[model samples]
Target: MSRPPSNTHDLTFYNGHWYVPSPPIVAVLMMPLAYLVGGKNISTADFSMFFSASNAVLVFLILNKLVDRQWIKLPRKSILWLVLLFAFGTPHLWVGISGRFWFVSQILTVTFLALSVFASFKSWSPWIVGFFIGLSVSARPNGLMSWPFVFAIAMQVMREDGQTIDLKKMFAWSFKSAIPILIAVLSLLWYNHARFDNYFDFGYVTIDGDPVVVQNAKTHGLFSTYYIPYNLRVMFLYLPEIHPDGPWPFLPSGAGMNIFLTTPALIYLVRRYEGRWWILGAWAAVFFNFALLIMYHNTGKDQFGYRYILDALTPLTVLLAVSLGKKIPWHFILFVVLSIIINLYGANWFMNG
Candidate 1:
């Protein structure tokens, strides 16, 4: 017998969530195949499957490019191990289908970062650079916050091989890269205006005139005044919690485990790769997350663990993969296994919860 249509708002389904719809726009763009198989029932969890899978593929490609560049190298076995690790290690890979925007945004954001890295290595046309940057911003408005980091990287590139920046060349490059950003901003404005009659309505921002409430809404609960200190204490002490009615399984509690466990390799990379372009990218990722946390805390509505920060996980993963290839022995292989185990446990916890 055909089952009755389930409640769309059930945690298992997509219809129950509350957020601006911009993320769905990007999710649909990235995974048109989801629409074909699940049609309109493509719940947030369903989209997460697509997003996480896509991210896995992109991470491999990005790593391949990095390997070829000699930034890091690994044996075939190690490469296999690393790939497996990333594919299974992160919790998002396993339980990300809960209809969260973080998985999709993270994939898009990381892809943009990879493209930017590629562009920095080659002499790409300004239009191309601009387009990618614009796409990055469109994927998430917070992406615009990374512009300074991008500029810093570009400046570093100009100083390539100890050479000085050529003013004319720099101007031309900067102008070209600005094109996509301008387009993205204008497009975002147009989208907002169409939906909310303001170029910057951002949905949640319109809930209340109070900046605190609006800002907290954006983080989904990680940085609210009450939750921030509480969560931070948990994270610092290595304690994980589970909330029955939380957005996702084991939230706030298991979520901290995710950040704490994965961040060590990232920290190691930053210190080891200091002054390198990759290090700058890592710093950008950190800056982006910290800024979001601060914004969320100021807003005072702590709910989720600021899960939105997951958007930066891609750059972090890439940085770790590359950096591990350098310092730890067979690091890729070992890390991958660890990541898979962690993700598996997290997923299992979510399913049971």
Candidate 2:
């Protein structure tokens, strides 16, 4: 829907001129805020925060339920701390205050994923989870692989009752959950076809003026094993550059910062056991989505922290909660505090830059 200048990046070269990627769902969501501020795009800086706040609430609710059900017990105070951690101790902090287009969509995906998880946790209708996944993929196609979450929740009943798998019930649940997802995938294919006359193309190859990405797309193709080293470095090994004299001493490289540095608390993920089927399913879901993102071209530019990591943040949170178990240890709390400080620095850098 956006028709910017020809040189502007992220536009698909269509039949003639440039066209926007994906419809303006974020713009429509921000309509009320725009009207409140006399209809200025500038007012959208708070739009991301709206979803961020919703996510905080969702996290709190999820944690509280886990405690109540004794799935992963924690004190009330610990719940509040984890909620704060998700809001400020992670990349969501940098994403929350940004008015930029990509940030808005990323934060919305965070919220949508959280809502989908919340629905599953509450044992609500499986369709709700599928519907939210449909919404999530609309925001970011990486979410298309979130289908495992549907299966995870669908099997919750059997797991809770300690019953053996029933193929017929499983098939029924799979059928119900697949309806919205099929709609989303078909709709996305149709949108791509309408734009570029190619059902499978999302126009990443036509991105304007990015020679490195284009070269990589040509040499290694759009998604290839060649990108794994670079993506792995950025996702885990890359660190901030030391500028002894610059006002900001440790600046993240343009590709993005490592997740462990920004949120070291995530390292607790290894502590997440796979004793439960749904928990294993959660890991599968996140890794399934992450595998596609890690292999894709472009490591996200002009971002405060690793934005792609946010895709699996919700499932990771579930794992984190499980890892915490009955008590919140001092070191985990310290890791979370340090994470908040680091992300706060990131938010400052992005807002000022």
The parts of candidate 1 lying over 4 Å away from their true place are 1-24, 27-48, 73-82, 94-96, 99-103, 119-123, 147-164, 205-238, 241-258, 262-267, 297-306, 325-327, 330-335
Cα lDDT tens digits for candidate 2, 1-353: 34557367766677776866664457667677667765744556676788889989988887776676667767767877778778898878888788677778888887877788778777667688888887887777777676786477558745675756788877876787678878877888898888889988777777664689877877787798788888888888878888889988888776788888988888887763856766777788888977887898778766766878878877788778888877889999899899899989888887784
Scored by lDDT, model 2 comes in at: 0.77
Q: TM-scores of all models?
A: 0.69, 0.91
Point out the worst 10-residue segment of candidate 1 by lDDT: 8-17
**CA displacement after TM-score superposition, residue 259 of candidate 2 (Å):** 1.1
RMSD to the true structure for each prediction, in A, is 6.8, 2.6
lDDT of each: 0.55, 0.77
